[model samples]
Target: MTKLDDIDRAIVIATQGGLPLVADPYGAVADALGLSAEVVIARLDAMQQDGVVRRIGVVPNHYALGYRFNGMTVWDVADDHVEEAGRRLCATGVVSHCYQRPRLLPDWPYNIFAMIHARDEAAATALVERLATALGPLARGHRVLFSTRILKKTGLRLGRQQGGGTPCSG
Candidate 1:
């Protein structure tokens, strides 16, 4: 495991929930943490290289953007073709994310899951049809499971700052 310095820990804590939504997010974080924007960026970059940080990405709120219906389109893809099928689905610009999972026998057989967002149930159904056609021979079967509610989305975070001071404290 990568041992985090105080400053690194602070950076993680500051960003774990999400980056500050501002013109200059890093600068905002640095201003709050008593550090420079460059320092925060450098630290985050180093932490990512060291595997302390995996990925930094946007978590779009589709519902707020008029995409009220979000469906998890599970695909029963042939093991050999799953990778290619997933790549193709992602390339279609319909899927927000796609991943492969272990299939359970008998009751559950889906191995590939992709998420799609639409404005309504009809749109969702249309997207499912489009995706099914896209999958073609690779997918044996599929299901569209709509999300009933929102779930908390957060990143890695520490408990809290131990004491109030510059995160550079050693």
Candidate 2:
């Protein structure tokens, strides 16, 4: 990893939220940063090569985009098979994020979690069923936790990514 200079910091701060939605998003960022768009693109390319940027793209607001029903589905899987099951769940396309997480003893027993977005709960549950079939008996049990309201949706924040202190991810 390399220390971010002032210019790099400026670029990071300028594009942290995401590239501008326009015909020339990078150019827009460059204009704001007082640097050439070429420089911005080159820096971003280097960042990706260095693993400083993990992903870059539009993150649709599922709810606003008519994906009205989203479920944070959880499953209690056999410890040895959770990883493979997670991969299968991710391949389902309905799953936006899937990973294994710690479970609280005596209360919460789900070890694997996947987020599913859909137009309705039934549709989301159908995806969960697909995941269950993929996992077979390894998935001992499961539950789809649906949010009743949007209490919070944490937007992108800087300094959360690895390898660099800069904010930009593109």
Candidate 3:
């Protein structure tokens, strides 16, 4: 396994949950680490280059935000057309994630799935309509599974930090 130096580990520890929703999140992390922002950036950039940091992406809590209504729109697109369909759907800024997965022939026939978030049910439906128009004939049929509740919401932390997560409770 690749070892993380003290500084890199500190950076990961500070950001495991998320970066502060502030004007300068990197600066906040740097201050916490007692390192300059430039150095923090440089170290993170290096880690990313070396593949230590697999991905650095935003993790927005839509439910906590005004976008309380979320819809998992799944589509049954032609096997040959799903690729083009995914590319088109991705261009539709309303979509947060668009990807294909296996379909159960009997009960579940949908293969493509996209996540859309909105303030209410109607807005979420409207976005689904836009998605249908964007997907065109690539999609044979689709359904929007409206999220009724958020059972659990958390992120997958990589490796143990100085002061890490809690023990699982049965």
Candidate 4:
């Protein structure tokens, strides 16, 4: 496993809250960390290559942007075909996020979860219907739970900045 030192950890922390809106955002981070912009950019690139960071991008507020309807579509797919079905569902532009999660049994346990968004309920429902048709009869048991409110959405905190040491756990 690759381990990050103080400098690497600092770079990760600095970039997590969305890149600064500037002519040279990475350069801004480098200045904040007292390092050269080239070094910060290089380290971030390396971190991504090493799988330490999945992506560096903005987290847009879809609702504020007019995507008022968001739904969590859960499917109870047979274990053998989960991956195939998931890939197919993800291929749709309407499906923003898709993944296979363990079923929580009676209370939950649908296995497949997808985050879908649209301008309104009707549009979201139509997209769901399209997905169900694509998945065939297996999608008959799927459930769509449209979101009523957003409780929270924030960046993951990987580490702390204490004792002049590396701040993140990764």
Count of clashes, each model: 0, 0, 0, 5
- After TM-score superposition, the amount by which residue 84's alpha carbon in candidate 3 deviates from its true location, in angstroms, is 0.2
Error of 3 at 139 (Å): 1.4
* Candidate number of the best lDDT: 1
Q: Please provide TM-scores, in order, for all candidate models, with all chains considered together.
A: 0.90, 0.84, 0.81, 0.85
**Model 4 weakest 10-residue run by lDDT:** 160-169
Question: Which pairs clash in model 2?
Answer: none
Quote the positional error of residue 157 for candidate 3 in Å.
Answer: 2.2
Error of 2 at 94 (Å): 1.4
Instruction: Give the true-structure RMSD of model 1.
Output: 4.6
Residue 133 accuracy (lDDT) in model 1: 86
* Candidate 2 to native Cα RMSD, angstroms: 4.6
Instruction: Give me the runs in candidate 3 sitting further than 4 Å from their true place.
Output: 151-153, 158-170
- The weakest ten consecutive residues by lDDT in model 1 span 161-170
Q: How accurate is candidate 3 locally (lDDT)?
A: 0.85
Best by TM-score: 1
Runs of candidate 4 with Cα error greater than 4 angstroms are 106-109, 158-170
TM-score winner, 1 or 2: 1
**Candidate 3 residues 78-132, lDDT tens each?**
8988888998898989999988999999789899999999998789889999999
TM-score of 3: 0.81
